[model samples]
Target: MDTELGYSIIPLAILGGAIRVSTPFLFVSLGEALTERSGRINLGLEGTLVFGAMSGYAVAYLTNSPWLGVGAAMICGALFGLIHGVICSLPRVNDIAVGIAMMILGMGLAFYFGKPYVQPVAPDLPAIGFGWWSDIPQVRAALEVNVLFLIGAVLAVVLWWMLRSTRIGLILRVVGDSTDAARAMGLRPAVVRTCATAVGGAFAGVGGAYLSLYYPGSWNEGISSGQGLMAVALVIFARWNPLACFGAALLFGGAGALGPVLQSVGISEGYYLFFAAPYVLTLGVLIATSSPTRAMTGAPGELSITK
Candidate 1:
């Protein structure tokens, strides 16, 4: 009976943790999807995530409002994206190089600015309770969902719809699929790409806000845990589709949650090994999806020229 009970709660706990942990992945991947769809890639989102975490935490601490912190982080991230865009727009400039430089700069700025907030406590973002239906205490705690998760879910649907039907989405697709075509249509590829990158960065900022303002719920030196970088791969895995990003994020989140679920169920043996499961899963996904004979399906044509 005890073993049966453990099995039941374990999956529930993992499901809850996946929703919580994947929030950042969902936001960042969606942002990357937008950027990549515009025929540009920003490898420096890791820096953006770090900076956002710092800025969001600081603002929340000072203003007593987590949402304001999210706003500040978004602004900061947009600025970073803007800088990256400007550099990449110059003739003969390498987007990847510009992205790397931007990441370094963002991390440096974040470290300088985030130092003071490390010790201070910030207001936590509010969470939603979906576990009221469950009688078990562990299940209830595990089922506590954050508001951002719901928002992210809605965003996925909205983005999917807009991309398929909106004019702006058409323009982005054209720019990504063919530079000459965009030029023929009198569309400025540079400007469009720049705007896309900025918006993508803003989304990454929200992801960072979720990191510091919710899970772990504090400012620290290592807040992102490479979710920004993971998001890039996630965008590729999702074939640049916004809706696919949400699913990929949940998959990654489930991998991340595996260790804790086992530990919670009194299965501590080799739990440390399970902790690396997320990274392993990422690598495995990349390997399985890799193919030389076929081009990446749904990849933006301009994406190949970034190198």
Candidate 2:
């Protein structure tokens, strides 16, 4: 390879890593963003994510179609969210405690169903190529990107617009800001939260599907490693903005890829440290964004966790 070509490869590799690794974070973060915007925190998303991955992989393995798996995952995720929402809507149930319980339940269900799928070879999702114009071998190689990334980008823009300029978005914001205000305006807080949770769960399910059907085919216990939890932190760090979640997810993705990228470059020292980079970065951002002194300025007023 030419010197300049070799030099340019690093950036390309980083970009590839960002796209590949960020898919899960993007999905989960967006889901969390939606849930938080509706004035609830679904810590159970971790369970939803893992369970969705297992369900998606198993369905794809049995049916030989990745889309079916994705659909199934979404359904399962929505069901999980519905359960969480219904339980949380109860008079005195602590959302956090309920979230933890749901997480355990979701993971258990996933593991039980996932046992038979540990070794199955499943169909993978198709990727969209944007490298048609690139004649250079490295350029072509570097430009191979997933179609979901584009879809996610579009979703972010749509969500931003919806939140800023739509009636439904206004209702969600009002409900999040003040349940009394929502009630005074004839809006049902429980109904809105239920819908939001269900929608967020669907997104999280898609993220899990992406994990099993695209980034890594087949099912296994180790398919995920706290991507869902980190995504919850990411939503807080992004201040519940969909667009900011996208950027933050990309950054987390890059952090996640550091270990493997370092190994590729022949530096394997402190491998575990590389894996911890995303978590550490997330914690740092959370600390900076959350402070009693400043009172988490952009946070929705009705959010229990932030308050």
Candidate 3:
């Protein structure tokens, strides 16, 4: 029986699954990239992701509109970011400690508020049927790409362009590179970082909406599965570049799908080990990048150091 099911793992299946699973990762990493670009690091997005999932699921249940749910989730995520930004802006506060606290608060609130929506069916996000030209059912099924994924892809390109070309981007770059320089240029670093963090949160919310409103398509306590936390490491690997973040998201997504794909191909001898691929990959990346003597390459100066 398992062998018959395993026969279906192929390039088409892996590609489709990679796109589907990577959507959330892409969004979260992009959000964090933006935050870090503004000289701030927000580790609390894990809570925001879960909160957005819960909030999005609940709002969709109530309004019968998945988009509205997305909006609600964005709002929820923004609030968390705003809180983080505002608190961090105050003197003598540690951003990392605050992030940990915010994450705990967000998770607690999400679990409490999300309990009612778990059993209810929320509307699913619509998908574009790109598989129509394919003759094979498996190929067709694999090509049913979700609209949010396309949006995130486009967003990655746009973000990359904006960060490199726009005036606002220059201001952000200055702020991230040096608070004193921003002040010299009559720019307010706190304001820029706060806005950046809030916007970043909104993007993370959309990722959460993708979770509950599309893939998996349900509200549950375990819906997030550590994607948010993993995004922080992904941002590091991507060098805070939005385009790189997009590529890294796909890589992580592909890594995550390895287990399921192997099982589909009747390779059940080490089914459980395949599931460990993503985590193992993440650990390897962290280990490879670990250097105590110098700062991680490409890190924003203001974020990695107070001076």
Candidate 4:
């Protein structure tokens, strides 16, 4: 009976964790996908993510409204993206280098401003309990989905459609594929990329808000745990596709939840090792997708990393 119980909980626990944990990744990857598809990259999303978490938590604590916090975080993230876009637009400027600098600046600002709210209890975002019909407690817990995750899932589909069927999407794709062609058609690549980057930043910020306003709901310095950085590699692995980003985010979330899920099922012997699964998975993804002689399968041609 005990063995059977363990077997049942493992899958349930993993499913729950995947749904809860993948929300941030889904948002970040979607944001990155949009930016990259517009012929630009914003590595500073790490900082944006962190700052968003901080600001989100702080605002939630102060305003007593979790949704307001999310809004604040999105605004902040957009500003960061805008700054990155504007700076990288200047002649001879390297977006990657500027991104790194922006990352440092964002982290610094978040740390400095977030100190006061570290201990405050903020109102958490509500979850939609899908397991309401279940008699088992674990089943209900496992099925408690955050609204943001559902929104992200829907968003992936919407973005997938937009990118293929919309004129705006066509212009963005054209800009990403060739700046010269964009210029020939009276389109401004720099302006388009800047806007795309800002929108992407807003997405990352919402991911951060998810971290603080929902799961692990709180403000802290180490709250992000490099999820922001991992997002960059995830975009590559997804081939810059928004729908693929959703699937990849779930895969990553499942890997991340393995250690905790195992412990819940009384298999804690190699606890630390299990925790390393996500990073290992990330490394494997990068190695498998990288090439010395050619660009990624579906990468934007104007992306610097490919060139």
Number of the top-ranking candidate, with lDDT as the measure:
4
**Candidate 2 C-alpha lDDT tens digits along 1-307:** 4434534555666677788888888888888788888899889999999999999998998899899999999999999999999998999888889888988898889999899888778999888777789777656655666766777878888888898899989998998999999999999999999889888888888889889888865577778877888888888788889999999989887777777766666668999987788878878777766667774766788889867
lDDT tens digits, residue span 212-233, model 3: 9999889898999888999877
Better lDDT candidate (1, 4): 4
Ranking by TM-score: 4, 1, 3, 2
Predicted structure 1, TM vs. truth: 0.94
Model 4 ranges off by over 4 Å: 1-4, 283-295
- Residues 96-133, candidate 4, lDDT per residue (tens digit)? 99989988898899999999999899999999999989
Local distance difference test, each candidate: 0.87, 0.84, 0.88, 0.91
> Which model scores highest in TM-score?
4
Candidate 1 lDDT over 1-307, as tens digits, reads 1235657876776787788899989988898898889899998898998899999999999999999999999998898888888788999998888888888888889889899999989999999888899677777777788988889999999888878899999999999889999999999999999999999999898889899999978888788877888888889878889899999998888888889878877889998799998878877877887788654888899995432
Poorest 10 consecutive residues of model 2 by lDDT?
Answer: 1-10
Candidate 4 local lDDT, residue 120: 91
Q: For model 2, name the residue pairs that clash.
A: none
**RMSD vs true structure, all candidates:** 2.1, 2.2, 2.7, 2.1
